[model samples]
Target: MSKKPFFLSIILFTIFLFLKGNLLAEETVKITLLYTNDIHGRMYPYENSIIAPETEKIGGFEYLSTLVHKEKQENPGRVILFDGGDIAQGTLYSNLTYGISMIDLMNKTGYDFSVIGNHDFDWGKEKLGHMISKAHFTFLSSNLVTKEQGEFIAGTRPYALKNIEDIRIGIIGLACTDTTVFGPESNISNYYIFSGEETLKFYIPILKEIHKADLIIVLSHLGYEEDVKLVSKVPGIDIIIGAHTHKVIEKPVLKDKTIIVQAGNYLAYLGKLEIEIDKSTKKIINHKGELITILNSQIEPDKEVKYILDKYREKYEAFGDTIIGETSTVLTKIPYKECTLGNLIADSIKITAGVDIGLINSGGLRDNIPVGPVTMEKIYRVYPFENMLISLDLSGKDIMEIIEQSFSGFHAILQVSGLKVKYDSSKPKNQRVIEIMVNNKPLDPKKIYRVATADFLALGGDGYNGFKKGKNLQNVMLIRDAIIKYFQEHSPVSGKIEGRLENSGKEK
Candidate 1:
């Protein structure tokens, strides 16, 4: 009997010690989120100085893979890798292969979840569907809805839940509404994009009332400003990882209880977010954001990824090197002003569309075609936006108004073909077009005229709202395809300086 009492006492004391130790220990959980956005299909580091002279060779998938591996080593099982969006377009490789290479690279990198960017629809919904089906991670886009099956579309989720030890995190996604306005017709023609705020309002209750997630994260393709608007309107969001505008943020900007961060375009920077959450409440107690530059000199790429990249490179080089045509002089892209190359592209469009005049936005010109014998590569280098050639029939009065509105906010130099105009820079806004002509004939306000321009400018974007009001708009073909056809029909096109400027009325 005495031995039984002693044994019971020992058991009680052991239980007491165990409970006391656990109370004192109070283990803390820490998680690190590593992210990239606007990785514009740059599978390899930039090479060929003539093509990309100003920027250093950097941001290859090989280097990114190596960095991810190193970060994993440093944090063991507590690290998560993610991409915001825009992984589909912007390079020859992306354009040639229709985003397959980027999809393959992203799958290899093991992205946990991503939102659908506007460019993701470049190859249309079918290709995007295939990529989503093939992706190893979840693709989330809440605002995208479908009526095909009277339900949501394929390859998209409103949100994804991640459980790291005892902490529960809910990551939601929002794509930009402008995708409907600016994206290719095939991608978003059938869909309706709802306001991000409205979508979040419905989901916030679900996440909080039902799922009980500890932290809420938003994966948004909406630009930084839109994300800021989202934070201000929606309550309970903890963090937002943004893309679209390609704004490189060095640190997280706090708005009330929410934090916003964006890594710049072209995979040039990786955003690392380190967070400490309270064990009981699961709310963030501490957070830090760091933007890591993917500089060539600083990073040594992983050999495995490099080898795989080499294999893709070998396959791409064969088709990419095919000779097409030659350029007599260099064609460059200067965003603030019209360049000679910009004029050439606009001229080609005007000629192809059989329009009276042509205009192209400076932002549409992606790169410079170095002065030399032009090739297929050179054409691809100069006009990389892949915008379609849209011809619109406008009265001379409408054309003049467009020109005036274009020069409203900033100095917009028009690259013209088959047109002549004189401007006074000192003139007030919308009155700068001092003189206008069509094919050496003065413009008649009542006379109808045809004009050719890219689809991007026609939508009132790039500060060209005058185009949206124009009539008889017709989209004939893609800009690059038109250029290619132009060269094929009229080989050896000689450079022409169509002096459209005739009179300068009191220069600024």
Candidate 2:
């Protein structure tokens, strides 16, 4: 071959290479975002309360693992997975290991990063440290900090900068500041959490300027409304994956310059967001999101994740399955109102403590008992907390204050025994409690009465401070133990809505 022709051929090949590189750079990039929030330690499948037929159950790490793996397989390197905290402390399996089991499962579930939720701190900072140490994914939180030093918890960073498919993505992490108010005193005392707006204000600049992030995704554990508020205050975010409210946002909400979506809670649904980013502007030009209800009937459980789940299950399932008692009526939890289940729990405490009154927060009571044999696992689902009983002497006036707090709309309304509480929902918060009759006698301010409640209330959990003024304080037995003992003695028991808590007024 002639030298001129060879050199000409070489120049044409170099031009082709340059053109191809530029064309690839200008082309749009597609990325699939997979997210779950507030798994709440649902290691196994259970009846889907929302879905019909009572037995069309959903959720479980096994089915979740299969769905997620399939998505990753379909998309390859374009898929990014994340969680929105609260991996532990809801079910028996999670409580067995104080969240380490869920962490272990998430490690296999292929999480990229997550933000801490209030419940994630329920076991306290020490146990949270263990979760952090065990998580294979990055823990990101811009707001969670030590009370004294104002530093992010060890093993957690303010945010993570990831380069996926040549796109620089920044994920800002924020936890619910209300954790300080709702979480247990011991768990919250060591840390101060910041609101999402302030945290985003501080970290957005760093991500934009320092890391040069092309896309900013906020993994927010703040409730849905709060996420909207944060977006209003600060701009520049492209996406927000939110949790904490357990609000099933079926569609992504588009605000100013961002889109917000939450998967709901308890591993019931996985949120998927498909977006096409402009190669030049680096903005999400097209996007669609949906919540995939994790129905075990539809998909085969991933074997690897199922093996891990089984390992944890075998360790705890045997004892959790022990039949404790039976219920003739369904003990349901009607939120923010007096419930039959609450009455049973409150009655258990009252009878166990031999006190004049027994009370439990409706917020503390979760799930309902079916009309059949009640197992230890069912009881754990209802009362998952480790709250112990506290016997305290309170003046009728102090007792009045506690009743007022229950209707104050801060926490769930109180469940009561030995007292008939009449409340008007239309009235203002503190004034909602219209009348209280102790043992059918009108509450007298001067009279002193022994009261039974959880130690969590005495410590001001759920913003209930009236229990703080209680005198003759004595710690009784674990509420869980009292419940079990009640079940053993009172099989085929029924908790009816006996008008212990009567609503005199209607909703405004």
Candidate of highest TM-score? 2
List model 2 lDDT by residue over 1-508, tens digit each: 5799999999999999999988875687889999998888888888966653576778888898889889999978889999988778788888879999899888898989988877877777788889999999999888878888878887899999888776899998987787424555346667776777877888889999998999999998888888898777998888999988888889989988789999888888889999988878877789998999998889898899889888987988899999988999998887677788888888999989999999888878878888999998888888887788899988999889889888777667788989998888888878888889998899999999999999888776777777888899898898888889888889889978888888888742
Runs of candidate 1 with Cα error greater than 4 angstroms are 1-27, 47-55, 148-150, 179-181, 325-330, 371-378, 385-387, 404-442, 455-477, 485-508
Q: Which stretches of candidate 2 lie over 4 Å from their true place?
A: 1-26, 179-182
Model 1 residue pairs with clashes: 325-374, 326-374, 327-374
Whole-model lDDT, model 1: 0.77
Worst 10 residues of 1 by lDDT: 499-508
Query: How does residue 236 of candidate 1 score in lDDT?
Result: 88
Give the Å shift of residue 442 in candidate 1: 4.6
Model 1 Cα displacement at 501 (Å)? Answer: 9.6
Q: Write the per-residue lDDT of candidate 1 for residues 299-358, one digit (tens) a residue.
A: 888777777778777877766666666666655655534456666778889989998889
TM-score of each: 0.82, 0.92
Q: What would the TM-score be for candidate 1 when compared with the true structure?
A: 0.82
Indicate the residue-level lDDT of 57 in model 1.
Answer: 74
Q: For each candidate, what is the lDDT?
A: 0.77, 0.85
